[model samples]
Target: MTETAHPAVSAEQAGIEQALTDQVVASFDGTPDPRLRQLMQALTRHLHAFIREVRLTEEEWNTAIEFLTAAGHITDDRRQEFILLSDVLGASMQTIAVNNEAVPGAERAATEATVFGPFFVDDAPEIPIGGDIAGGAHGQPCWVEGTVTDTRGNPIPGARIEVWEADDEGFYDVQYTDGRVAGRAHLYSDEEGRYAFWGLTPTPYPIPHDGPVGKMLAATNRSPVRASHLHFMVTAPGLRTLVTHIFVQGDPQIEIGDSVFGVKDSLIKDFDVQHAGTPTPDGRALGGDWARTRFDIVLAPAGA
Candidate 1:
């Protein structure tokens, strides 16, 4: 028996798809802001290219729309599902890389920036130097000390440093419903540019995995766990704001993979263990084992 011949896709069909993409991109030509017009056109072109490359079906498109809708529905002031989705997709890290490129003519390297995870909040309680930020979060206490300095090695006095992290159980303050503020706070560097705080020892934890983003990760057979880390956002006058994380050295999750792709070799540090009954740096009475780590942060000049 002779097999039936199948016709190839017509050139007219390909032309129609290209014309549609061109029309969508051109629709943004009237945008008043040049940057906005460029962004819109680029986004339209890339998005249309993706759809065409995938040859997406109507069912798949509907599923994607439903997934995004679910993510929006689950988002609130306390939890941002969109950011989580971006993190799992590595979009957040890519944006950070694009915006935080290296500074030219710098004598010393600045601390690398990473994804500003979904848990940051405005107006965190301010604590004095060497104060505790753990509030009431449960975990082994960690003494986080660091000096804020410019690329030239000059101290940056009075820089504002914001710190936030997950507790031993991998839960952030916002994850709880009792209006608790633990494992997070802000502090200013001292006159000598030294800042220290008490926070939980970084521990590997899964990203909030009960939402649409989590579902996607699960469906794709990917783990949602992030490497053990402590978040920092440091700002000073006339310096580029720095947002990054100091990951625990030797965390297995780092080798496995950080779901958000936020790890950098330069950002990893050793968390030294202090056995019980050891004297604390500030002579605070801690009756149990604790950890300590120092992170010296160098900031780039504002326009650098």
Candidate 2:
């Protein structure tokens, strides 16, 4: 018995794919930035390869274009449908990974980075240390305390800590039709590099699904839920700013996988559920059972 050999490509189709890829890449030569030109050329090659590999049809291409157009139309100041699109597709996470990677022989560990979701508002209300940032949102009250330290363990004073999260109901302040802002604030570290504030326990929440990203999720049979976590954007004058979240260690959504692919094991922390009688670090009494979390951030030197 003998096996048949595959046929060679016809002369007409030979090099056609390469020629198209080359032509598209060549068009990027005029890009002013050398890095931009390189990226455009590489992207062109990969994009063309995907089209060819999928044997994409004209109708399918049109549908994709229409989907993107819808995403753009639905985007606005409050709603960032494009970032949501990138998040759900894991592009945002991939870009974060590439840009925030640690060096192989770095002296110390730097806080891991993650996606910055669309809910963040500019100039979130600044609160005093130990003050509540939740603004009486609907959720169990909890204390968030942490220190900002350099790679060598020295405390960094006056580090800006920008925090935000969804309430227990999985709705952020922006989602409220009443135009109220809650569950977000900015605070500064004290002389000891320590910061503490009252915030609601993080709860699993679904990304905005009323837009095109929602349609995409439905079409692909994917959930629009992100894991329970609190977002933080920490920055110090001489250190690299760290944008990340502290995920609930045992949240079921962690196993289910985050819709935005933002969870990292290093960022997972125990949200210690406590009874009402328990005393908080600030000598405050809880109205009921609530959660508590401690996260110490380590920042790398700028340009490191």
Candidate 3:
């Protein structure tokens, strides 16, 4: 029987390779923030592991770098290609999931949060409780009513209920070249935590595919269509602010896939269609066919 010894050169090469990653990790040791130092080291380790596992080619690496560079170049105040990138890749949703835990059994579930798409604007034309947020945008007239309540089913009075969405034409006000603001508004809940507003039934829209995110989706043979849904951002004192969507039930695009992966079964609701001359719940007259949807929201206590 014979015993074999490992080559010294192989061991040396392995140590050298490991040292390269260790050196980078060690460079972050002096970071004043302990959390930052840990994050940097962890990120470095995972990044190196990925590179090593892939045995990445120089050309492929350069292509990736160029792609990222182009993503930065196309980003602007109005167009956030980076956020779009994160969204399409599902990183944003994963981060939200990590931070938003589910309520345990025997307790009411808090409303699920989703990606805050880049189109939301501040000071979105505050309106009366029953006022129209759509500003006569070209879409089917829709009445949206909801109640903001705590997880225990208690009304949260005076909560801010903000709503925004694309029109029937599948374009948000921000997407207009004329700098117009439409299809979005904000209002406060009534004494009973009830909120109501006139808005267009959201239609399926393409997630701005003219930029790097669109290019990425095209390269990967994926669709950029987001499911039809209305965006809501609800806030109240002593409760966690919830950014979510009430998606239209039976939307074909949702069955396909939401580009941002923001869809949840609990968030889906029916947008009932009513014909002309039908009396609305709020006593508003409809000259033509319209849609109506009711979505009640549940908020968790702060830090819940």
**What are the clash counts of all predictions, listed in order?**
0, 0, 0
Worst 10 residues of 3 by lDDT: 1-10
lDDT of 2 by residue, 78-132 (tens): 8899999999999999998888868455556898999999999988899999998
Pick the TM-score winner.
Answer: 1
Candidate 1 regions off by >4 Å?
1-8
For model 3, how does the per-residue alpha-carbon lDDT over 1-304 read when each residue is reduced to its tens digit? 1112124336565566578888898999899999999999899988876766566679999988998998899887777888899999999899988877876661578999998998989989999998999876789989988898988889889999889999888888888888888999999999999999999988999999987778889999999999999999999999988999999999999899999999999999999999898898889877899989999899988887
Candidate 2 CA-lDDT value: 0.88
Worst 10 residues of 1 by lDDT: 1-10
Model 1 clash pairs are: none
lDDT of 1 by residue, 1-304 (tens): 1111223436677677778888888898899999999999888887877777677789999999999999989999989999998898889999988888898888889999999998998989999898999998999999999899998899999899999999999999999999998888999998889999888899999998998989999999999999999999999999999999999998999999999999999999999999999999999998899999999999999977
lDDT of each: 0.91, 0.88, 0.87
The CA-based lDDT of model 1 is what? 0.91
Decoy 3 TM-score against native: 0.93
Model 3 bad stretches (over 4 Å): 1-14
Task: Report clash pairs, candidate 2.
Answer: none
